[model samples]
Structures are given as structure tokens and as C-alpha cells.
Target: MIRRRPPAPLQDAALVAVSLIDVSAHFDAGEPLRMACAVASAFSLLLRRRLPLLTFLLTLPTVLFSDAVIASLVALFTLASLSRHRTLLAVCAMAFTLSDMTSLPSPNLDLAQTATLITLGYTAATAAAPVFLGQLVQTRRDLSLRLAEISEVRDHEQLLTAQAVLAKERAQLAREMHDVVSHQVSLIAVRAGALQVGTADADAKEAAATIRRLSVQTLDELRHMVSVLRASGGRPTELTPQPSLADLQQLVSGSGIEAKLMTDLPHDLPPTLQRAVYRTVQEALTNVRKHAPGATASLHIRHEGDAVRVTVTNTAPTRPALPLPSAHHGLVGLRQRAALLGGTITSGPTPDGGYELCLELPAEGTA
Candidate 1:
């Protein structure tokens, strides 16, 4: 359970009212100067938040000339809370103690008396109280801010760990798809092709041809899937070490195809930006697999000015590419993500009988 503190204006008004009561209790009717000093000191507390030193100075006359001291204590506390200069706070505290102990008009200088010594101790204790409370408040606020920053960093690390795990799993899945699924589909297409050539009846010939075409199409889709799965964190071994293209050979070979990854990229890129690059590569690889069967692919990641550039290129297909239905939603999604992060994605066919895809992301990773 918690209780909210009163608004500042209301709290300030209450302090002022209390100071006035203290003043009226201490000052006599015939003494105009004493009454005026106490009245001015009480009003000065309104300025404590903005001009603490000036507020304390205005209240000091009351401490010296009259018994009213609430305004001066309040002002001192405000100064301590806002300012970090320990030397200044100590000086103000000493000034306040000396002012309260010395009775003016006819000063009480007989410190040898027990009453005088007790009064001195009492005034010193009163002045130290506000300074301690103000410092404690400041420390608590700073600690809270530090804790919030640490928590944010921890959340970000957790997200990266999750992505790493997903990448490793996808790599494993891609292996299964390439070795098992693709092999079965390839055999089906081969058998259907042989049947189409051997069949004599027109209806049988058309059916065999349709089966062969559908099998080949499915095989093309499987190749795309194998590439997407290889987008895993280049075989993330552990979080202790930075993962990039270090284990890339394993991923390229694991695809059960001829692929290579080359990077001169810095290891300290923002995790979000890195994730975006990984997604872009997934799409590029998928395009290569679907449209260019038997093509050799290469990826180059590097720094260019204030941004990161990742380019994927694949040699032309050994077999004739069969047309497949596509809305190109994956490429559109990548472009939209890049725009949000103040980056860009571009792709085209290469002059060397290959296709090239490039993604550029701001190194600062700001949107």
C-alpha cells in the first residue's frame, strides 16, 4: 500500500502558515522590527525551491533577532536536496547553528553555564536533521535511475539470446529439409519425366507431364526453404563469443550446396540492426534457391561510411528456371522494415550471369 504526497503548492502553503504561527508565538506586540523580520522570513520560504540560498538569507534575520526558525530550516533543506556541493552545505549549516545560538540585542556569551551548553547542543542537532534527510532523498532517487538502466540492458540481452536459440533450431531444420525432403522430391520428378517419355497414349502422356511439372515445382520451393533455414546465427555456439560469419562455412556447407559468406563487418553492431540483416539474407537466399537451382551463392557484409551493407549474389542456374506463382511479399516486408529503420534494400541481376541482393542499414540503428 502507498500514500501519495500532497502537491507542491499545497505543501508550500502549509509550511508558510506554520512559520507564521511560530513567528506570532515568539514576537511581542511592541517590537515592530522583530515582527517584520519574522513575517518576511515566513514569506521567503516560497522562493526556497528556485532560489534556496536567497530564501535562506531572508530567513536568517528571523533566526538572529527572534525565536522563529522554521522558514530558515526549510530553506536549508531545499538547498541541500538540490545542490551537490558538500562544502557549501557545511558552511550554511555552520552559519545557521551560530545564528540560532547567539541571542542578539544583549548576546548570551556565558557558555560556561550548563543551560547555555544544552541550548548550543539543541540548536546544532536541529540544523543537522534537515541536511541528512535531504541527502538521503537524493541518494534514493539516483539509485532508482541506475536500476532502471540495468533492467533495460538485461531485457535486450534476453531478446538476443532468444534469437540465437531460434537460429540454431532453424539450421537443424534446414539440414533435414535439404537431405530428406529435397531428395524424395527430386526422385519423384525424375520418375515422372521417364514415364512421360515412355507413355504411348495421349491422355497418359499429359498426366505424366503434369506430375513431373508439379514435382519439379515442389523441389524448387524446398530449395528456397533450405536456404531460409540456413539464415540461423551462422551456427551460434555460445553467447559468450560474438557470433557472425565465423561459423558461416558450416552454414554454407550445411545447406548441402555451394555457398560462401564473406564479411569484414564489426562485431558491435546493434542487435536489432543485426536481426534485420539476418532477415534480409533469408529472403535473398530464398530467391536464389527458388529461381536459380544449382547456382553458387556468396554473401558480403561490410561497413560503408556510416552504414552496414550486406550483399548476396548467386551464379546463374544450371537448369532452366520453371515459372512459379509469387506475390513477392517477403521482399516487400524487408523493404518496409528497412524504411522504418532509416535504411534501404536493393536487388538486381548481376552482369556475371548471377542475381545480386543488397541491404543497407544505418550503423547507428536509429529510426
Candidate 2:
């Protein structure tokens, strides 16, 4: 029987130390032993990075030629444990088996027994080490990728939430501004027209008195709106009374739009749906006054089972359309209001050469 010869302890230790030193020095550009160290260092680096073929090829010759079996075993262990490719590890095991079977001097044991023992030992080490190590590394990499993706998604969600909060605050501020300014301006216009039309001193005095009364009312309303705005801070609240479908008739009548209202609204409709309908009509009337002065308008409201539909249509202006000097917030505000109630609003030129606004909102409980 052929007995395996264990490597000398000092020689085995020296080879391991040399291999480690070579790998460390590979990072240095000005090392004296750079050229000689390159051979071992390159293989060591490949093994660390789990490049199986390169590691196997570089270590194989050294293992087969050296008299020290311990050094050969160390190289094989490095290959099996570090490399990811199973085929390369198997090839290295086969090479080690061939080297041991052909080289070992056996007086009693046959060649087949030597080959079988070497194959069994090398195969066990190569299969067990590389597979376990590879799985551990892959698992770590997968976990890192998942963490990175989660962080990205969290960041995106936070950004969207911030944007939504900002938009809501802006809309609230705009609503406050419109409510305060529009009513005050209308009062001013009414009083100013009365003053312009008056002829006698007594009539002028009466007009001035009317102007004073209007101004006081405007100031009071503005104060109330500002107080409400301040009390809310930056948070969105439903504290303000939203206008409902009934308010649309008042808005149109006050605007001098010659509007006709048609409605079939259910008594049990949601406040949000009513608010969306009212805002849409109000915005459409405002647009008619600004963009098509002296034109007639019509408002149609219908509650059809699961949904509420609103349509506002206005005739084209006969005179030259004057450019509106103020900001166009009405339509945009109406759209936002509709969207908040899970509704849709559309405004554009009608096929009959007029402007039109159409809105739809889901009924209560249906949404």
C-alpha cells in the first residue's frame, strides 16, 4: 500500500507566508519583488474575486511540481473555497488526483486504489467548500440590492407626499384670495357705476353713501376670510363652508351672464360632489365674464344614478374680446377641486364656436 507523505511543518508555513506576502505586495507599484510576486498574487486576487478558471490554472502547475503535498493541499483548499465556478473546481480536483496517483510510490497498493482514494478526498473538499462560500456571497449581494431598491422607493414616496402637501396649501391660499377679492371688486364696480351715472348733488351724495356702505361690507368680509386663513395655518381642513349646487344660480345671477340652470341633483348627494359641481359652474361663469363679455351662458346639472354631471356653455363674444388683466385662477382652481373629489373637469372651445366646461363626479357611497 502507498502511504501519503505529510509535508514538513517549516516548509508548509514558509509557502503560506510567501503567498500572503506576494498578494499584499501586489497593490504596491514600487515593490522590489514585484515581478516575482506577480505570479502568485494574480492567482490570489482571482481566487478572492471568485474567478475560478484563472485561479485553477495558475495554482495547478505549482501544486503538481512541488514535493510538498501540504502546500498543494493549501492551494486546492483556496481554489475550492473561493472560486464560484463548479466546473473549474472539479477540474482542479481531477488534476490533483492524477498528480497524486501517478507520482506516489506504492509497493503494495494497486493504481486503482490510489486513484480512488485521491478522487474521493479531493472531490469532497472541492464540492463542499466552493458551493457553501459562493452561496453566502450571492446572498449578501442580493440583500444589498434589495436594500438599495427599498431606499430609493422610500425617497420617491416622500418626495411625492411633499409635493401633494404643497399643492394643497397653494390651492387653499388661492381660494381665500378669490373669495375675498372677487366679492370686494364686484361691490366696488357696482358703487362706481352708481357714482358715474348720478347727475344732481343729492344723487351724488346718495351714491357716495352707497359706496361707503359697500366698502365697509367688503372690509368686513375680507377680515373674516383673512382670519379664517390664519387660523388654519398650513394644514388642509374642511372647516370652510363649501358652496353647493344651489349656490350656482346665485353666482350666475350676480355675474350678469344671463345663465339658465337645469338640475336633477339627488337630495342625498355628497358634499364633495356638490362642491365640485358648484365650483365648476362658478369658474365657467367667471370665464364667460372675463373672456366673452356680454355673452349668454347656460348651466346644466344632472344626477344620473351613480354619477353627477355638470355642463357650462357660453356664447361667443360679439364685440372684440378684451384681454383679462388678472391671473387666470378660476378654471385651474375648478379642475383641482374636481380632482380632489375623485372627479374630472374639462374646459375648451365648443364645436359651436363657444367656450364650454364639463365636469363629472361620482355620487355619494358610489365613490
Candidate 3:
């Protein structure tokens, strides 16, 4: 809570008193009633800011009867600085000041001559000065506000630029990691395959076969990472070695949950579409683990003319759901992946209180 300093009431009182004293010195009045009226007009300066137009209206006519020129000048300044109708009020104040000066009694001069002398002399300049100063202050304030808004917009743009640069750097690092790890894992799989074929002992051959399978799975995961990183645009074809619908069996075999695979996939589907299907299933199963633990899940991949449909459904949790911190971006990432492949994805609760995720991708995929 920001506490503003209170207005200085004592200071305002002192200033009003001093202004009354200054006006009294210029007054040529001997009657107490005339002095009281002049003092009242001078003290009206206290309501200048809160009631600027009203103060000006009330004090403007008093200028003819009282020597409160200083107070009236202050009222004009306040009205010009604070009123939305400042231009009209400023014009009226100037005109009224001229009228007030002209109406003052003059013994030796004619009315026109007296009016001309006051309008052309110090009294006219004094009446115009406050309006000019008020306009100057208002202009400065408007300029300052505009500069502040421009500065805020510039700062926001700089922040967005910095975030874009950081995201690009992170994506580059991920691609580099995928390239290095996938290349090494692929090499290991090749060596393991050769060892499996050449080994004489049955146990040794089985161990080599297992190592080769795990290495291939690792390569598939790395390829998925590469696909994600390159989704922005213009990715090199050689950078991606995507997995297809063939890997769905190995994908769900070792999980604790009961899950089944059903597929009628077409041959020679585009790698991008295949990768999208694979990621959709992966993200669905991940969600099942996080949100519906001990659930039975099913993976379905079907061919429909020139497009492929993939669906994953999980039953209600057989055990109590685990308390896992979920960022819930997995489904969002799947939707983006499907969209990049010219596909659409939908997910919602099943009729039986389970969860169902569906994706449909074009066989030819999108650029």
C-alpha cells in the first residue's frame, strides 16, 4: 500500500493569508464591508484544484469590486491546467479580466481611452501570463506520459526478443544431443546385431539380441526428439529417422498396465505421419500413467483411404491414482505434432468414465 503524503493545510492557510495581505495593500477602501469582500475573494484560492472552474467562475466578477488580482490570476491558472474545457475557460477568463480592468473608475480619462491603456499595458500581460504557464505545464505532463508508455512497449518487445533467442538456443542444443546420441546408439545396434549372428553360444546370442533391441528403441526415442525439435520448419531430411506403426507392439509390451494394440495400417505411410501416430500413442499412455494409474489401455491404428486414424483408450483406474505432478503439456504437444503432420487430435473422457484420445493424420503428411 502506497501512502501519499497529506496535503499541507497549514501551508495553504499561510499562502492564502499572504495573498489577502498583498491584495489589501493595493485596496483603496476605508469601509470594513469592502475589506471583508476583498478578503473573501482572495481566500477562494483554497478550492482552486478541487473546484477549479467553479472557483474561477465565482472569483472572476469579484475582480471589478476587489483588488484580488493575484487570487483571480491563480484561479485562471488552476482552471486552465485542470479543466477539460480549458481553452474555452482560458478565453473567457482573459476576456473577463479585460472587462474588469476597463470597468474600474477613472477620473481624467474617457472610458475608451482607459480601456485601451489597460488592454495595451501591464494589466493585460498579467492576466494572460497564468493561462500560458498552465498550458506549458499541461503540455509537459502529456509528453511525459507518452514517453512512459513508449518505454513500456519497448521493454516488452525486448523481453519477447530475449525469450525467442533463448528458445532457439534450447532447440539447437536438443537437436545436437539427438544427433550425437542417435548416431552412437545406431552404431551400437549394428554391432550388437553382428555379434548376435556370429556368437556360437545360445545365451550369448540371446544377450546380444536383447542389447540390439534396446539400442534400437533408444534410437527411436532419439528420432522422436529430433522430430519435435525440427517441427518449426525447414528441417533436413537426414536429421530424422522416424519410427512407424511397426513399433507399436514393442512400445506397449513391458508396461504394468493391461493394454491391447489393434491396427489395419497401410504400407509405405509417410515417415512424418508415422512419427505423429507413434507420439500420439506415447503421450496418451504417459497421461494414463500420470492421471489414471493401474488402468487398462488400448492402442488402435487404422487405415482410412488416404489417411490414418490412431486412437488410445484407457479404462478407469483399477488402483488409486498416484499423486504425480503433471504439467499437462503432453496432450498439447501431441496436438501440435498432429497439426504439423496435417492432422487433428481430440481427447476426452470415455462414456465409461475412462479417457479416450483420437488422432487422424494424412498418409502423405504436410511440409
Best by lDDT: 1
Residue 314, candidate 1: alpha-carbon lDDT: 94
Candidate 2 Cα outliers beyond 4 Å, as residue runs: 1-52, 67-84, 97-119, 157-241, 246-266, 284-324, 327-367
lDDT of 3 by residue, 143-222 (tens): 99999999999999999888776666656545445434543564466557667777999999999999988876776677
Every candidate's lDDT: 0.76, 0.61, 0.68
lDDT per residue (tens digit) for residues 1-367 in model 1: 8899999999999999999999988879988998998998998888888898899889988898888998899888888888798898888888899899877987875789999889888888888888888888778888888999999999999999898888877765664455346545654565566567768989988998899899878877876776677655244222322224344444455553467888877656776576567667655765665678678898898887889899989998887554543435457657766886789999888898899988998888432
Model 3: ten consecutive residues of lowest lDDT: 231-240
Question: 31-118, model 2: which lDDT tens digit per residue?
Answer: 4343333445333433433554465456544433332233345555555545566686666666765554443233232536777677
Off by over 4 Å in 1: 219-367
Superior by lDDT: candidate 2 or candidate 3 = 3
TM-score of 2: 0.50
Candidate 3: segments with Cα more than 4 A from true spot: 1-15, 27-29, 84-87, 102-109, 114-120, 185-367
Model 2 RMSD to the real structure? 11.7
The C-alpha TM-scores of every prediction are 0.59, 0.50, 0.50
Order by lDDT, highest first: 1, 3, 2
TM-score of 3: 0.50
Highest TM-score, which number? 1
Q: Candidate 1 versus the native: TM-score?
A: 0.59
